[model samples]
Structures are given as structure tokens and as C-alpha cells.
Target: MRNPSSTGAGRLLRATGHSWRGLVDTWRSEAAFRQELLLGAPLLVLVFALDLAPLSRALLLATLGFVLVVELLNTAIEAVVDRVGADWHALSGKAKDAGSAAVTVSLLVHVAVWICVL
Candidate 1:
């Protein structure tokens, strides 16, 4: 029989693979994901150009990471909503709106952090 640890490692690898595929799917389907990538890639390059303090650089990195993560979650929420139905039910609308709010909050945090740091 295979070792239990090996089996567990296989499961973990499979799960990671699924998540990576989902990220790519999200990127392809979601306009917001593309926008975030466009905005964030340049900002990340600018971050390196700025010659920032170590602490400031760390904060900027954190904010950029937050934007990426939140965008992913928003895309996931939207995908689930679309999968559920293209209908305009109230709960479905709320779920999409909440996902939008999450993106907004993340953006606000990014703005606040960068403004404070720079």
C-alpha cells in the first residue's frame, strides 16, 4: 500500500493544481481581474523605481498583495453566481454587490496605505 503521507501529499498537490486553474480561469473571464493586473503590474514596477524606505516598501507590497487576493475572491464569487444562474434574483444580486464592495474596500485600503507610505 502507498504511504499515508504520500497519499496526503498527492491530495495537497491536486488541490493546489485546481486552485491554480481557477486563478487562470478567473483571469480569462473577469474584466476586473484584467484591470487589476494592468494597474498593479505598473504600480509594482513603480514601487521598485521609487527608492522607498524598507517599511514603506513592505506596506506597498502588502497592499498590492491584498489587491490581487481580493480580486481573486471577487472573481470566484462572480463565477459561482454565474454558475448558479444568470437570473436576477435578489440574493444573487446581493452576493455580486457584496463581492463588488469587497473590491472597493480593498482598493480603499490600497489607497490609504500608499498615501500614508508615500
Candidate 2:
């Protein structure tokens, strides 16, 4: 028979893989991901057109990545809120609003970096 410890480890690996795939699916379905990709693609092109130094180009890309990352977290929060219930609840509203605020701040930061760098 297979070792019990190895079997348990395999189950854990599968569970982790499944959870990651679910997150990826959510990212694909979310409109926020589409918006970010649209904006980021053009921003990346502009950065390239500017012919920035290697460090500056990297910083610009990193800032855009931060915006996308925050968007994914916001999507996750909204998904959880909806998953919990459709009915209005103060705490649920606050959680989602807070997540949106994070996205806003990330975008603002990206803008600030672009202004300073370019």
C-alpha cells in the first residue's frame, strides 16, 4: 500500500492546486482584470515608447503590477461578500468598499510614479 504520509501530502498538494485554479478563474471572469489589462498594456507601450532607462522601465512595470494585484484582491473580496449573502449588511458593505479603496489607492500610486518617473 502507498505510505499514509505520502497520501496525505498528495491531498494537500491537490487542494492547493485547486484553490489556485479557482483564484485564476475568478481573475479571468472579473471585469476589473479586463480594465487593468487594457490600461496596463497601453501604459507598458507608452513606457517603451519613452525609451526609459532600464530601472525606470522596471519601476513603471512594477507600479502597474501593483495596481493589477490590488484589483485581484478587490475582486476576491467582492466575491466573498457576494458568496456570503446578497442581502445588505453593514459589515459586508464595508469590506467591499474597503477593497475598492485599496484599488483606488493603488491606481493613485501608479499615477504618481508615472508622473515622477516620466
- Tens digits of lDDT, candidate 1, 1-118: 8766456778798889989998888788888888888899988998899989988988998898998899888887887898999878999899889999999999999999988977
Report clashes for each candidate as comma-separated counts.
0, 0
The 10-residue segment of model 1 with minimum total lDDT is: 2-11
RMSD for each model, in Å, please? 2.3, 3.7
Clashing pairs in 1: none
Off by over 4 Å in 2: 1-24
* TM-score on alpha carbons, each prediction: 0.85, 0.77
Candidate 2 lDDT tens digits, 11-106: 788889987886678667987788788878989899889978999999999999999888888987998899999999999999999999999999
TM-score for candidate 1, residues paired by index: 0.85
